[model samples]
Target: MRKVVFHKLCAELRSRALLEETFHVTIEEQVAMFIHVVGHNWSNRPIAFEFMRSGETVSRYFNLVLDALCILARDLVCIKSIDTHQQITSSHGRFHPYFQGCIGALDGTHIPACVPMHMQDRFRGRKKFPSQNVLAAVDFDLRFLYVLAGWEGSAHDSYVLQDALSRTNGLKIPEGKYFLADAGYAARPGVLPPYRGTRYHLKEYKGTREPENPKELFNLRHSSLRTTIERAFGALKNRFRIFKCQPFFPLKTQVKIVMACCALHNWIIEDGPNVYVYDDAAWYEALPRSVRNHTDMHQENLAWAKKRDDTAKMMWEDKVGQTVP
Candidate 1:
């Protein structure tokens, strides 16, 4: 980390009195220890060896830093209003007008977890490994807007999404705003998903064949935009190695780490250097394929389906003049 960035963090924490210098340890060292543990998934023993401190001391400071970072979550993980003017000029600007009310993309990712033997089965998913299902929503800037962790890995994406929507204060969509999700989720009034039985992933569009119809065109654009959340997840795991592997911590601590990592991710995007670049293809290839049951569309679902169809038709008509036969 740069000196300026380090000092800025120290200033913020110091102002909040969330972190302070111990008898022999400065706030800088404390912050460095926490970053090292999260960034590298280092155990207390190895961290103690590196810092020349006792294992217990290292563990204590680690908890303090973890708690402090969690306290900053409210300020870090926040959803911003969509900027229509900016979106119209963005790299994916052509499709911006069609999804003018889109807030971000939503998806679920599985992170390895360590649970008691009796509870292991509930956390084990298709990967045959115990894990936790983490649902995250991210905007175009690659910042996490909302994150819901701690769900058993065996939980389905749609189930987790329903949980998020059911909570009184959980993931809230504005009156007209919607979020882009994949087929694993049920398309509804507040969420837009690609048309089923259609090419969605970027790898599917590698050949000379392009979108043949309006639905294909809508799916093509949706895939392009929804990819931002996948890239965000990739960037998050890449920066925090703890998320990449199962850390030797209690289930509660592990869950907190997930939230803290997300909070830090947003902080880095807002204030840190712009060195993080997302590899869409790499992330897509790493994902595990799971079979999802087709959700029966009901009354509300039908209305949402009609809305999606209308949007697809509008987009196709707007670009029909430029499309080759």
Candidate 2:
């Protein structure tokens, strides 16, 4: 985080009465300690030593700042607007009309978690170690629209999304608008996923291996646009060191930390300096989309599937017409 953005966050916290400066420790120091801990993944003892304060003091202020950030998240992590995003509007017919109703993309990520041995079975899944399945939505600009963390690693992505939608204040998809999701999610009314058993990932269309049919063409374009969420997750895990290892905090605190980090990520992006490094290409290479469990039998709706087919046919027809001699 930049110095200007740090001060801004502290000022915002104070303005909202989320935090106050004590005689022994100023709000700035308290926030700095919290940032150091999350940014460096330092434990209470080491953070206390670096801040020249007792371990108890470090832990107290860390939680205080964390609570404040969580409150701030309600404002930061949200949709910029309900209007059509400029990225799609300015796509020069690439995605303008076809995906104009797309508000953003949603995906689930596994954040390493530390749990007791007795409950490890429930937490262990695709990853070797236990983790939490965190679902997040991101717009074209890489800002987080919504986040739902704390689900066990063994939970399926579609199940987590269903839980999120069931919540009162969970992700809201306005009428006529939807989000692009990977095949891990069901093709519901407000959710769109690429066709299965088709060339979906962008890497599949490299070099001269262009999309051959309407399904492949639509999948190619869908994958290209849906990368926004992937990039958001990439930038997030890249910036915060805490995600690199399993946090020793309780399961509840671990979940709160994920939410706080996402909020802080948005704050730094919007209010702070724009020093965020995008691992667009590198992140894709690290985790090939082909390996994802797209083969899973999701409860795809017929209406949504027909909508996808219509969009793919339109896109393919346009491509064919433009290439005519």
> TM-scores, in order shown?
0.88, 0.90
Error of 2 at 75 (Å): 1.0
For model 1, what is the alpha-carbon lDDT of residue 194? 95
Query: lDDT of each prediction vs. the true structure?
Result: 0.81, 0.85
Model 2 Cα lDDT, one tens digit per residue, 184-289:
8768767999988888888788899988899998998899899999999999998889999999999999999999999999888788533333223232122111
Considering every candidate listed, which one attains the maximal lDDT? 2
Q: Relative to the unseen true structure, what is the C-alpha lDDT of residue 130 in candidate 2, on a scale of 0 to 100?
A: 97
125: Cα error in model 1, Å: 0.4
For model 2, name the residue pairs that clash.
none
| Clash pairs detected, candidate 1 | none
Measured by TM-score, the strongest candidate is: 2
